[model samples]
Target: MPESWFVPTIAAPRRPIGRQVFDFDRQIVVMAIVNRTPDSFFDGGRTYGLESAVAAALAAAEAGAGWVDIGGVPFSPDTPDVAVADEIERVVPVVEAVTAVSDVVVSVDTWRADVAAACLAAGASVVNDTSGLRDPELAAVVAVSEATLVITHSRAEPHVHLRAPRYDDVVTEVRAFLAERIEHAVGLGVPESRIVIDPGHDLNKNTLHSLDLTRRFAEIAALGLPTLAAVSNKDFVGEATGLAKPDRLAPSIAAAAVCALAGARILRMHDVAASVAAATMIECILGFREPAFLAHNV
Candidate 1:
């Protein structure tokens, strides 16, 4: 049992998790983030070109990424036009290239319906939306594709959203936001099987709020849907470790390990290789593997 939160419906009928939205058939799958933008906070512009994007995707697959989330724009509300076609052009090639080569699931990271549709057409299995289904069209896309729709909770984008972020209780606020978004998407025809929840971290968030949410990942898991945690080497890591952006590897690994133990199903990470290693260690310690270590050089 989790100390932070408890299951609301203790007697609620159980649903087999084998074929859930994110598919818990496997243990602690990693979702590597291949940001194809010029300013995606971390690892931006690293996969700008088609070759680099393809290489990045292949690398993630090689690093044991159960899924790779290919993102284009940085999701900044202040950003200019960014037409649907441009977003597709930026991510479609990567999607096609990666999906063509790897059997691992590929999730498209975008908020626009058109972009998500195009990426799906190009071969994306899930839609990772950061706006919490604020866009009706995004709901429509998810409804039609029935793709795993990851809805993240965020307050009114204080600066660009024409409203301020006022939260008497951030945890309750985020949970309510995701609940509403899930209802909205299901109302538009997306099944419960297609919904996944992510508690937004770092993006438009203060350090304390991020820490609280990270520590309370069990509460997010209590939502009954697969939880995808996107906390890979963001400012929150720096806040906790006082490490610069380049030195966030340890904090990122620690955060991902904690989330995995707390029931995070998907880890959206920048360091797929290191995170995979960390997740494997956590799995071993969690009694998922035999407690034995052969001679492997440190």
Candidate 2:
């Protein structure tokens, strides 16, 4: 267990998502996945259309997710490249619709600057750069907008498969990479509070590497900044438990529990309801959140 947990001082000034501000110190933000791509590994394009995507976002909010990460492209190299205009087309309407109807924070999962700018304009409160800022200009767009930036660590460019990438120390390297990117984003005028770091578990790492990062997640949280764990149905979790994508929810929630115990503040997941329940339990255990109704236990 960590000596100190949920340190609010490490987060940026309250991050505004429309009218709501997320206080990372007191909240475990559940960012529900809403992939607009037809080829997403998890959903198989279930929310590919505008209406379905908007519905998905609203449903997640209803299920207790504080944020919805809408992505128009998959990071796998096997997935085809989406044109900037088409990417914008796929996400903007969803962003606009979700923001219009729900108070949940909307985050656009894109590595393209143009697509990011358009989504931010459409009312996304965050830009989740899964490619590790492959497009240098993406940071500038986030810097200028009221949106926050999620800088993840990926060893290769978007869509390129990383075959057994080596690292002297996986945790140390991820921490260093995220630190540099955070500094770079701040240098570009993004406030430190408006920035969050993700170690990019399966984004560029193998099963063992992701497991190590999750186990040593306390080190990442020690940076005193909000860290995001996007472990929902990821290959690492599947590989670890021999579960397929649809059946990985149990292990996914288990990994999320470990992440929460290690002090990770954000959990990006596909099963919003289950993740919220698990996170709520973890939060209560950590004393960061109290039980809904204290009865006999009190």
Candidate 3:
């Protein structure tokens, strides 16, 4: 590996999110995704029920996930709007159930302020907003609660699509957007230590743009905050490897490893166990973790 590939890891910091402290300088955190939306692009209603969503989150925690991100709606364009009440109903129960039983950090993936406030009251500690804070009130909610805010970079509204999104430089633009959003959130009384950034792979960008962001992910990591990479079973992974969503696990793991090596502290993944293994291997290679029972050639 080139020396440049490891530069960003040197700047990773210890970030305290909610009740857990993530030492990004020495470990990688896997954030399992559990969408409660019936129209989720990945699961397609598999865990939409309250029981199923909670079960899936617990399973992910058991599988070595440090965090579980529960969402009530998909960001795909043309998906029907889920009313704020309905969205809260869909996600809050899962958050309440998971946090009541497990030590895993629970995050609600919504951009609406009301839903975020409800989830925080339900015991969730992080707000994973993928809309780039289109609703500024969400920042105030996070600030008032003193929970972690994941500011993801996306160019479109929640249910609206941007046709043919273009960026002069994807990584640079993403870094600038995240920096601005971090400042915006901090201005609203959100502590700077409680903010995370995501480049929003495939959220509004095409495969080429997403790939570029992944290739240059270290630039985003260098922003000196805990960076998140949500590259699990996304359209960019599918398009890059010419595989359908169901068949993209290997490529998704590959992408996760790449991002981990490039200084992504948090990986939001659907396949919890497999992604955990990949993250562990990267940690061992980077000298941040010791191999478990290394007897093969010891």
Q: Which candidate, 2 or 3, would have the higher TM-score against the true structure?
A: 3
Residue-wise C-alpha lDDT for candidate 2, range 1-298, written one tens digit per residue = 3553333345463566656777667678899999999999888999998899989899999999998999998888888888889899999999999999888888999888999899998888899998877677998898888888899999897888888899889999998988888888888888887888899988879888999999888888878788899998899988899888879999999998888778788999999999999888877886777789968956
Q: What is the TM-score of each candidate against the true structure?
A: 0.87, 0.95, 0.96
lDDT of 3 by residue, 1-298 (tens): 6554663643437766767888988889999999998999988999998889999999999999999999998888768988999999899899999989898999999999999999999999999999999888999898888699999999887889798998999889988999998898888888878888899999889999988888888888888888899999998898889899999999999888888888898999989999989899898899898888768866
Q: What is the overall TM-score of model 2 with all chains considered together?
A: 0.95
Candidate 1, residues 1-298, lDDT tens digits: the string is 5576432221122323212323352367789888877666676577877798889889888988888888887766665556778888889999888878778788888888899889888878789988777788888887787477888886554224533345677777788888888888899988887677899886557777788888887777777777778888887789889998889988888887777777776788888888888877866766555546767774
* Poorly placed runs, candidate 3 (over 4 Å): 2-4, 7-12
User: Which sequence of candidate numbers ranks them by lDDT, best first?
Assistant: 3, 2, 1
Top candidate (lDDT):
3
| Model 3 RMSD, rounded to 1 decimal | 1.4
Error of 1 at 20 (Å): 12
Using TM-score, give the best candidate's number.
Answer: 3
Question: Model 1 segments beyond 4 Å from truth?
Answer: 5-26, 77-81, 157-164, 291-298
Reference-based TM-score, model 3: 0.96
lDDT of each: 0.76, 0.86, 0.89
**60, model 2: CA deviation in Å?**
0.6
